[model samples]
Target: MKQAFLTALVCSTICSLGAPLKVKGLRTESATNPIGVSNSPRLSWQLDSEERGNFQRAYEILAATTQEKLDEEKADLWATKKQQGAAKLLVSWQGKPLKKGQKVHWKVRVWDKQDRPSGWSKIATFVVGEQAKLLKPGRISGFESSSEKLNQLYRQSIANLEKRLDAFTEGDVAALGDGSAVHRSARAFLYHFDSVPHLTEWLRLMDSEITKDNFFPIYPGAQTTAPVSSDSGVLVTHPLWWMSGDAQPTRSRWDAYEGHIIAREAQDTLLKGTKWGGIADSENVAAEFIDLCYLGFSCRLILELALPAVQPQKAIRFQVYASRIRKSFERQFVNKDGSLKSKSQTGHVLALRSAVLNPEQKAKVLADLIALVTKNGSKVGPIGAHFLPGVLSLTGNQDLALKSLTSLNAEEQKNYTESGIAEWLMTFVAGIDTIAPGFNQVIISPRIPSNDSLSWVRAYHDSPTGQISVYWKKLSPDSALKAEVMIPTGALSRVILPIRKNQKITESGNEIADAKGVEIIERKDGKVSLITQSGKYSFLIK
Candidate 1:
């Protein structure tokens, strides 16, 4: 709950300027070396620099269970070979068994853009505590106890925004206060969780603040409309407007330019002989078009989740609207080869993420998306970067997703981006996601790919029902993939464990025999699925 500043360490004097390259600001959070958690914590560091555009090209980290091991220049726990990427923060930990309450000592060194190597960072330490200690205040088993801890994070995030709801006045809406649409926090809660505590009230307030014109002003004052031209549309209030802060024109300028693009192309075939005007502008027409498409995508995701529970009748209306926009988006943006007209990373990723592509088009689009990133040397701008991991996982490319998410540089500091990547590590790649909001029912399906850089994972999610934990290991190609799961009381889980071809699964050194609340669903295509209820399970796939 309390935040601490990251500690910086001075490196050996190796730079041309004769100053030591300082690795500064190393505060570990939930994703990094968590104070008390089941899963392995990640590590991140920042370089203190005065040079213009200085950045890290690669880095290596070493960790030990004790200071003695670390001082001996040995990685008793783990040592990362130099990893090539700009990402210096939230690097996943791959080390020996880290038990609860064991202190971790670690240090890092980096290679700069000029190919100069920095000296090892000063040793830093973090006390390990149980997630249950933080959440339930009791001694409990591993990752399962951490689920409540993770859930509390979401709750806290929502509570923080709930207190600020009143500050978003009509003027704040027009100005796009805090770089997002006023309803961003509310929408985030709606999208991720099953429901919020005060759903109806939250929606009502959001609706009242965002008017039909969708223009967000810094200060609404007494005027109902933004001072800018009426041509402004949803672009004026897009949540991601701040991402393009580097764009030469301000929000108003981009909105006006987008309006011009729509009006000018109203008669084009892509425009369908209709004048659909008003949107956000970007570096290119395709980027601008994708921005509009993203708006429709956001609406679709929201309505898809919110409608059935709250507004049943409005379902058809929202679906129709979302469908029409999606079709326009696909027709205009998605090319025949499954590439975006813009060929931009964000455009392609959104095409997949926003559900603009049909099921049949997903494969091609995915391939193109991967190529786009690889072709560009794995560098994506801010807006599209955050979506990459989820997009990859949803497309059955967990291996690639993990690779992409960890591939980072010092430049990335976005809160949402970091958290999204962390979620992937904790849930999908680590093999745990709540099928039900509040994690009443979970799907424990670990996707430890053959080429995975990680050897093992231990993670937990505290659910409404109880704590769910999973510890998995794929020691080697010849060895069986082992898994241990702890299911909470009153909760049910669909466990889909991975297996090699021609391999069978065993539990307790024997074939997995069905028991009460444990039914073998099926075993085919290198996977075994089981319907499990409320118990601890250990299995080996060989």
Candidate 2:
């Protein structure tokens, strides 16, 4: 009896000392049991351990066509016996090439620092298909307008963006071209369609490449590497924070690098570019022009949104630096006639979109842009074209923006490998925009064309929280308008309706003042603006 007790105690102690780790958050290609995954998708998971100072020493993965096979340890598909490393993300599948629409069940286990093995993780299943590779539009987000040409343009733009998606690994997604512009444009497309999982994963991959000096590589996930002189991966953090409504990612990055380091790096880049007469070492005037705009814009964002909370002094310094760059931009690029010295469509568009230009200068630049487009059409390249429509609309020329949009020929539209068209259609034409990050607040002010070119517009965006949609029809030119809007739960919207001469606005046949879940903020600038909570609303103006 004494010997048995001693043996039992020893066994219990050994079991207790085993690694207290379990695998969780299993994902294939950054999605949980995602459908339409690649034939050879990458697997990833997180380790949960109650014990401190425990880290993964090695891992093993088992994949099979059926759960029973995995349960029985058959591993018909593939079995990575034990990969002796600490890689917990984007581990490639090696067993066999999965067929289209094939379902795969996978599980993983890991050994700890002391070589104590963890139990098997929960099984995750992914469906194999070619479609999984593309960043397609969400089911809840779509666009439709009276003009078929405009509708087709939106669809084609999405397709173009998808074609530009190049995977570094079997499951990793990155933009095809090098430079900040391509990746930034791709990210905007993903955000607009609410491709959260893909975007999050892509950002993670980009973040992993951020050097200790806070420099993001010009070409992510590529063998050839160089530091990006302009705002690339870092600048996209602002939109990601807003779209995800999660500040942790942004906060953590800044924390890792610290605000002062980031500010200093930016300042150095600016100084280096001063020699080249721009913010980056580019001989092309248009490239330099866009780089200057991006750098100044990124610095301004950091100064306003990121640094003040943690490093107030750094924020002040950043503001001064940004101000100097802005002044220098105008001095070097802007001609006496208010047109850019380069006389390129790209230069003008970048100038207009950037905060570097004041209102008067922007007006002059806008006039020049309109004239250039009017005379030559949209001669802007892929990068500059991304911001063209939005800039035009923000300058209060939505009509001109729409005209430029619909006038694009097939070949010209095909060259636009960015999300600009889709973004413009959703934000300007349908007029559904997020006032706060993650669609906690939105603005719905559809720019119904004053002319009869477009009779109606309908669109929706599935935000991280829920779906927000808007539809409007012109009952008659300058006579009556009908609009229907859906605000997701837990979100607020500010609706702006254009008030015609002596027109009265009513909701559900009742005065706007008496409508439920609606609050009249004001009537200003020939428009009625009202705030509303989550629900569907219909308005008529006659």
In candidate 2, which residue pairs clash? none
Over 449-512, each residue of candidate 2 has an lDDT whose tens digit, in order, gives: 7777788998888665456789999996566999999886445789998876688889889997
- Over 4 Å off, model 2: 1-138, 163-169, 172-188, 191-194, 211-213, 223-230, 255-286, 307-313, 417-419
Cα lDDT over the full model 2: 0.68
Model 2: residue 527 alpha-carbon error in angstroms: 1.9
- Steric clash count of candidate 2: 0
Q: On residues 7-100, what C-alpha lDDT tens digit does candidate 1 reach at each position?
A: 2122233333443345654534312233564446656565644332345778888888788898887888888879887655446667787777
What TM-score does model 1 achieve against the real structure?
Answer: 0.54
Give the worst 10-residue stretch by lDDT in candidate 1.
239-248
Q: Name the TM-score of candidate 2.
A: 0.70
- Give the CA lDDT, 0 to 100, for residue 61 in model 1: 81
